[model samples]
Target: MDTRTVFLNACNEIANRLDGFKILEKGQRLKKSSLDKDIYFEIYFQSSFRNDSSSILILPHINIYSKILKKWQIEQIKNEYSQGLIFGNQIGYLTPYNNWKEWNLAGLSYEKSINEITENIQQYLFPIFEIFNSKETAIDFLKSNGTKFNQWSEDSISPLDFLLCFSENETAEAFLNNFVNHCPYKGNILKLYEKLKTQNEIDLNYSEFHGADKIKLAFIKGLKII
Candidate 1:
């Protein structure tokens, strides 16, 4: 099945099983932080249970444009107030393809965070990965099925690029560090810090700061790249 078809089906199935669920538009505005003025199209689904507002599932989608349209898109992204949305926060996940390769997970707002949505898709999507055990196989799946992605320059890198094959402690540590360095919101930093700490005992490699005690993990979040 096509990845989009797979995704849409999974979402529709979820709506069918779960009461008060609704899938909204393909694009909508999302604000990352109060101080950060950039708006993102993260709210792709809205649920009546959540008061008819979107809880975005940020999947990767390739945007093709004519010369004039491309210029407009770049200009909009470059605005001083426009902060580029990072992975995990806004966009969720995608089926591995040459074109849309950065993310593959669905995201929920702080208000509508639900594991059921993320967990349900695993059963539907994981089997597709089983058929092709290699990275190339994954790419072939995307190239053949992902029409929008195929149009772009095939020079893009996949999520497998940064993922270290060896699951060493240092490898995980480095991954966490890079994640924090690129995060735009303090809330996410804290959430990831707690997640890391719960999963393993990691020393906070940062100095003290005011108001950090409230979050407890803030010290860890403030770690410098020393």
Candidate 2:
């Protein structure tokens, strides 16, 4: 009935429906571990303020540590690469409390808010679990759909990020080289190319880059050329 209770109930419902996933960190998060145990799918809820109303931000993210690649190796790709990667375009859902304000004003039940939260998980987050059940599947999904580094950011990891983690130095270099030719951010791309030319390993400090700068930095970091 309260916001926290409603959110926890929705998380519980999702956990119950999905096999192998259990709630963690109190009722705020849920995770399903991989065979390696270090890698997993993590879903959590955070509170955000926007548009003059409190909103719930539901995030579904993965943490991948490949047997072939050490965690540090991948972290070199993106400084914030602790969480594996996010798959597909439906990153997360932002459900606003304002939507339920009308019903609450009339003293009606908040079933609509509860149902909305549940549906958000079902429609946007549950499918991610189905698609990325395994490391291989997760990588394959990225290869097929993660060409665009449009929303590259510290908080969001892209498919291209995963490819760098799994690819060899020569392969990663080639991919970045080709991507730079067509990518919109020529200055940043050239900078990365220059860095890759001399160094085998590079750290992409996101703060150094802005706007499209982040996208190129991610490619350079992900490859970890050295």
Candidate 3:
């Protein structure tokens, strides 16, 4: 299968299986004129691009906890598995070579467009794949697991902080919205929470949240913060 074909097929599978999720894969050429000078394109062959050619499915909402709570969540997930944080669901990329290629091409004249697209695809799919290896099983697990908020005052910096530090404008906003809705500290612990809520700049739903463990693990993995 071709690279575009692989991404398309993977997106289709993810959409069909995962609930409340959407697929984002485009098999089109991005215009260089509209992009920054640092972006470029790369060729992908079906067989040789073993690690380079892959798919990811993101949960978007699985990373819905405050910074401090996220730290505790990581510890909890770690205790359950004998394997360290790098193994199992917390794994970041397909392999070492793939990650090396990504980092090497992150910001350059020949990496602007394709690299950006590749990065976005990776972000969207990996977490979803981890959470929902099997659609029914994932849904069932989410239902059984559920999301819960924990104290937000334990640590000064958190997973949310890390995501915000690295994420793009809109992505950071979405993550902050999730935190506003799911973080549990009250009164004075979280000054940011109060500011975000009172400002009403973000769309936060006051529903029963779930997946304390997954949310925490994801934040810990992505943020690289305890």
Candidate 4:
């Protein structure tokens, strides 16, 4: 079988075995949403092109999302610079078992790769989906999963966003007091923090907010935190 055929076949096999996920992007992506449709676990394929035209590595990536947050993000996109924070979910490869990310699916290895992928989804991802199945659990998870917040991080979920989205202004300010110190780009976080602490509102336009502020402001405005 050709490399492309092997990739598609493996994806199809996974779709057949997995119960809830719906096929997307013509089989390149798999999406499983929660019963309430508030949470989503997206499994997708990535190709690692090799120098040898014969070899292919079909890397599988899975990430979780909140249906509410997704919609909130769309509402908050006020300008060209403002962007969505898509990491309502995160995965280290198909599963995050010990932060594991290893994939090799080319030619005959497709069967083994598919098996491993299915097992990882069952073993690691399903449990996570259950954990963050609701916005309440998801907010609590981000608050507890302290990988240390970096205000400069582009894609990483900042707990502040959750706080702002959920209108936890008091807690968010306390967090910002310390978090801003860690972020060298503290201008935006601090400004937002001070506004919440004193005025209880954010007046900055989406364009005025830079970097991680995009997430913070989105939560504040979209969720109407004031």
User: CA lDDT of each candidate?
Assistant: 0.31, 0.47, 0.30, 0.57
- Per-residue lDDT tens digits for candidate 1, residues 129-164, read 232234344334433332122232221212211122
Candidate with the larger lDDT of 2 and 3: 2
Report how far off residue 106 is in candidate 3 (Å).
26
Tens-digit lDDT track for model 2 on 153-205? 11223344445666544454554444545555557645655666686654454
lDDT of 4 by residue, 71-157 (tens): 555555444442323353334532434453555676566578789878876776676566656767655644544223222122242
Cα displacement (angstroms), candidate 2, residue 186, comes to: 5.1
lDDT of 1: 0.31
lDDT rank order: 4, 2, 1, 3
Off by over 4 Å in 2: 1-10, 17-19, 35-38, 48-70, 74-109, 147-161, 167-187, 195-202, 205-207, 210-226
Compared with the true structure, model 2 gives a TM-score of 0.56
lDDT of 2: 0.47
TM for candidate 4 is 0.64
Maximum-lDDT candidate: 4
Give the 10-residue window scoring lowest on summed lDDT in candidate 4: 146-155
TM per model? 0.21, 0.56, 0.21, 0.64
